[model samples]
Target: MSIKEQVRQLWKTCFDDDDAFIDLYFRLRYTDKINKVIEEDGKVISALQMIPYPMTFCGQTVATSYISGACTHPDYRARGAMRRLLQETHRAMFAEGVMFATLIPAEEWLKGYYARSGYATCFHYGLVKKVINSYEQPVDNSVSCLNMSKIDLLKTPQERIYPYFYEQMNRRPCCVQHTPDDFHVVLSDLALSKGDVWIVDKNGVMSGLVFCLMDGNTLSVKEILLSDEADFAEVLRQLAASYRAERLECIVPRADEMHELGMARLIDVASCLKVFSAVYRGEGLYIRVTGDEAIPQNNGYYTVLPGKVSRDMQEGQTYVTFTISELTAFILHDLHPYMSLMLN
Candidate 1:
């Protein structure tokens, strides 16, 4: 068997997934140059896949990587293989100038597992559950919800419009940005990540948009945009009815629930902060970051400036002290978790 096949077998054994699904994943979403593996006696037992993406933070696009499909075989579970892999990944990311690394743990409890590797909670993820109050029996008015062709979205816009469209998508505090090609690549990837982009056009103008996926009886809306409130309810009503959903769930930017849908960790603090246009209004504070006992390099005192990040500065009094997670929240301007990226 090929090494990747062996690794997939290990992944399948651990995650209870089948071969076809595994094949689709490898063929579709694999990133280049960052796949790491631990070999033991001619077999790959542990692996990590780092997929890099451009994330927008406070109106600026920055390089960030998504750490996903991370798994270690049961035989290698207690041998510190995964921890070493993560440490190596972080160092490589820093060297490559990638500012941040974000990931969605397969389960919520796994957040604590990655926290040991300097990953903190930075993503807010949850399903917004709203029962269909009214479903097409008597609609308020007709809202044209149509799926636009890829060609159409890429074309038909003004010369300066494409850049603006991509920019506005990332205007929120910290969002992952995707190009038109990225959208096509994500969707064409064997439809492994399945969803439809529906635009609500009214009177020859596009007013509302929804990107949703059907899960069993529920239609989970990953993104919904309607700048005008007047069209919001009616668009949602149309969406709920059109998708034939039993329950409509939305993942808001900031969640109020007890648990989180996803988590994030900083690969390099200085790199991440450097990408920010400006830090919060202050005379620059000294921060002493603690925790990450497993990784000693991350625990240190530092001085943060508007355009500078210095380490081990003795001149500042540790006015701000926080864990890596808290630092992530701070860098993200409250870390009100939204869809990091690739909702499809």
Candidate 2:
């Protein structure tokens, strides 16, 4: 089999999801992504997909590679393919000047798999479950003064789609930023995945939207874009009814109860700290970080200010120290952000 074929077979075998959906997911969502693989005797034994997306941190954008669809042939398991492939990918990302690499673990057990590669839980998530019997069908469409509607995302024009996405991301703190081109590619991927995107438009402008994943009778709302609290309840009701979803799980629940959604690793501490520097308000602070072997510059002491950073330590300053992983989580902790479903 060729590389794509080998990956598809391996992915399906490992994940055991619907073949069609998996194929579509790889086709659309992973478009233009960097694929890293470990081959033994000319056969691909393990693979990882690096999907690039811009993540907004403290009001600035950082280039990020989202790692997903990780798979290893069962026969090749217990070997060092996963570790080698991850190390290679991380080095490549850092060389490319990518500041962060992230992933959402499909299974809880896999969390440990990436942590060994220097990933930390940077984003938190919240899930609220509604039983199949607990679901209440939506009411009439015309009941509310607000004109809410559901339309195929393909029908949503390019102009509206990008702006709406930007608006929604801005509404939620600590969201991955998307350009218009990004939305075009992502929406195209969604169409291929046979996913549903329902929107709430006020008058004629798009105000709220939701990205839902459909299983047999359960609907997973992966992303929610809304203007207010009432919009949330309204969209959920309509989506559940439209899709005939029996059980519903929402990733974006109340803020206080949010749990971890994904893992993140700082590929370039200096560059990433620059983005955060715009928001960090403090006297000149001296710090050192023990970095991964792949990136050597990351392990060092530095002088940092609200707008400047240098390798040399300052004369008099507030001193702090962190391992690379600890600093990754510590820097992002202030936002108190929940994991975003859209990234997954």
Candidate 3:
């Protein structure tokens, strides 16, 4: 059978859901690589897709591509369809001189699965916030929050906001590198499509910025960066007050390096790890992790190993051994709890 037929068969069987298929189809179509699928016998058993983005960071200049929507038919699963598709995609990306590939995994266990395939966990953060009712606006105190609605990206000074935003994000542990031009493009698109963006000014200079979106009753903060002198807490409070949102949410790095600038706090560590673990992958089998200190109920390290089993680390780094598939299953939440559910 031809590769195209294999991919069609695989998609039809694996993602039998019409809605999921439609979503997958649209995403694949948007990346402009759907036709790359190899077909055999009028069925698609395997397929791969790539999403391209122009990324700029300090010291390096290059356009990057991210791979997503990878799949193989259920019958072709153990036959190495995924491995071959990934291998081809990686080769193509390398030929294109792509910087790196990134994706949000569909399953947590897929992390270990991808790890064995050559992907690693780089950085992760969580979304958390308190829901406030009434609050005072920062503008009332003469604090300048630039209404992005009034500013034109084409007319604004790129030197003003681009450099500052890039520098601020670079301080975070897992932030992707972005160039001034790349930053401008991203911000310009968001500003045009989203609600008002608030910028905190110092002496007629842009110091901090925040982007907010309203979804039904909730106010979603897409990004928030502030200067050292700017009160991040006040900015958040003012934005929340203006929208009267019951809650505000934005992803923060796990290292909490930006907390001081934003006045943001970490509320749930385990949940954050669980969310992040969905993307990372590892090698080997039957892994174990042991430690010496008391593990916090909410925040604790874990060692992933073979057989979908994970040992919680208390003090020192405990040795762990496990199969790639097992670890993937565990992170994806596909594995059953070895311990009691109440404990988890």
Please report the candidate that would top TM-score against the real structure. 2
Alpha-carbon error at 128 in model 3, in Å? 4.4
| Model 1 alpha-carbon miss at residue 64, Å | 1.2
Query: Which digits, one per residue and each the tens of the lDDT, describe model 1 over residues 182-271?
Result: 555444432445666565555555555556678887877766655453355566666677766778777656545434555677766665
Model 1 spans > 4 angstroms off? 18-20, 136-168, 179-181, 188-195, 227-230, 255-259, 290-299, 312-316, 319-323, 333-335, 340-344
| RMSD in order of candidates | 4.3, 3.4, 13.0
Candidate 3, run of 10 with poorest lDDT: 335-344
Better-scoring candidate (lDDT), 1 or 2: 2
Please write out the lDDT profile of model 3 over residues 49-82, one tens digit for every residue.
6655433322233344555456766665777667
lDDT of each: 0.65, 0.74, 0.49
Q: After superposition, how far is residue 131 of candidate 1 from its true place, in Å?
A: 2.1
RMSD of 1: 4.3
Candidate 2: the clashing residue pairs are: 124-339, 125-259
240-285: candidate 2 lDDT, tens digit per residue: 7766678888777354456777888889998877777777898666
Q: Could you tell me how far off, in angstroms, the CA of residue 120 lies in candidate 3 after the best superposition?
A: 2.9
- State the TM-score for model 1: 0.81
TM-score, every prediction: 0.81, 0.84, 0.53
